[model samples]
Target: MATQNLIPLLIILVSAILACVEAQTSDQTSWAKRNETEKEVITTLQFYFHDVVSGPNPTAIRIAQAASTNASSYLFGALWMIDDPLTVGPGPSSKLIGRARGLYGSVGQTDWGLIMALSYVFTDGIYDGSSFSLLGFNPVMKSGREMAVVGGTGLFRLARGYAIANTYQANANGDAIVGYNVTIVTYV
Candidate 1:
């Protein structure tokens, strides 16, 4: 009888230990050190581009609103919780537009306005520490280009880093010609 009770206690203790270990490991995967920085980056890009997204009725007013809201939430989560983000480089507006345009072009002939609008926000969010894959936590760019990386977003799983822009582009219409080029930098 004592042995049976002791066995159960052992199992509980082992499970508790495993849980603690998992918790600590997750912390190691965090990018909390750059949380504030990521938020600033995301906010600057999101504010401007989200407005652009609103202007174009790619879907409908309600749809656009939902997309905007979702992007905002994703951005918040990316900066607040996500560690690594895919990014390009910050550069001249002309160059950024060029890249953004190129990406849309590659997307196989979609609506130009919608493409550009999405491009602006897409690149912006990426450079702002948005993860391609959201561990147990969801990434902000999940709905956008972040998922576009590597056979779409659902495949890539682990992201323990941040991204920075190498270039940027703004269009004459105050839209993006290319947008922002950024790169992923691992979180340490």
Candidate 2:
């Protein structure tokens, strides 16, 4: 009689534990499904990037370089830390929208290629306080160069996209005005 009673109690305990585990598993699955089913939004933006490598108030400054950097035609192993301005137009005095803050290094031996890791930190309009990260290779001498938008924060959370850059103007001092077109996808 006592064994029978204990068996019922054991069975009830096992069932309760199983139920708890199933509930937890189901809750996690539902959360993932919800995110997966959410709609995605694609947004495109155009802006100008001013990379001021010269003058008194330079935005980009050379931080490090290998000994052979100057001798190499491609500037291999040269790295620069940048806080370049992003604006509405190609001119330096254009209305500021954001900043491209990060670093780029010459990683190519045969070409003028730079490995860029930047954060597009916005400070105006609807995107203020939001920021997206970019990482890719930029061929400086090329007419049109593209980079990947890896991720973001704030309004741009979980963002993925691409950015195209074209040199609008450049001078012998290495200061440049570059135009950018970016397309991004984010969860709605």
Candidate 3:
């Protein structure tokens, strides 16, 4: 009788152990790597955000492996379609910003984030009267629509709310942008 009771208890213990082990194993993709196209896109986007969000003189590569998530793959792709998609920095300043302003400012990857980041930096990444006026004047008001109209990318549909929130803020005139996610465009 004791042996039979022990057998059942042992089975239960084994089953519980298996459950715990399985829980520890997740089957998600490692998106931070640059082996594939999508991962590379994410890598570039992360660097851009870290760079111009600071200034023309940022001198650090503080972005980590898990910068963005797998879910943001589409936004990264959209960025690739429009921008240079190069990793040109980790130097004294972010070369990604420099190249865009250098030779490809007109037809390069000018995502709403980049535009707003430019506005944000010009304003010293802080919103005062002079700063607010600059961002408000030539901001990305119909940015999503303009991007779609020009290239017809669906990033605007994929990440609209984030774009609006990141790309603009409220002032007496309207919203001001401290920073914007140039990659994500809006539909309506």
TM-score of each: 0.22, 0.84, 0.22
Per-model CA lDDT versus the true structure: 0.28, 0.94, 0.28
Cα deviation of 148, candidate 1, in Å? 16
- In TM-score terms, candidate 1 sits at 0.22
Tell me each candidate's RMSD, in Å, in order: 14.6, 3.2, 18.5
lDDT of candidate 2 over 32-126, digit per residue (tens): 99999999999899999999988899999999999999999888999999999999998768999999999999999998789999999999999
**On lDDT, who's better, 1 or 2?**
2
lDDT tens digits, residues 5-120, model 3? 99999999999999877765532233323224342121002223222323344322223223342235222222211111112333334443312211101111232222222221
Top candidate by TM-score: 2
Q: What is the lDDT of residue 131 in candidate 3?
A: 12
In candidate 2, residue 133 scores what lDDT? Answer: 95
Candidate 3 lDDT score at position 54:
35
Candidate 3: regions farther than 4 A off = 28-37, 40-153, 156-188
Model 3, global lDDT: 0.28
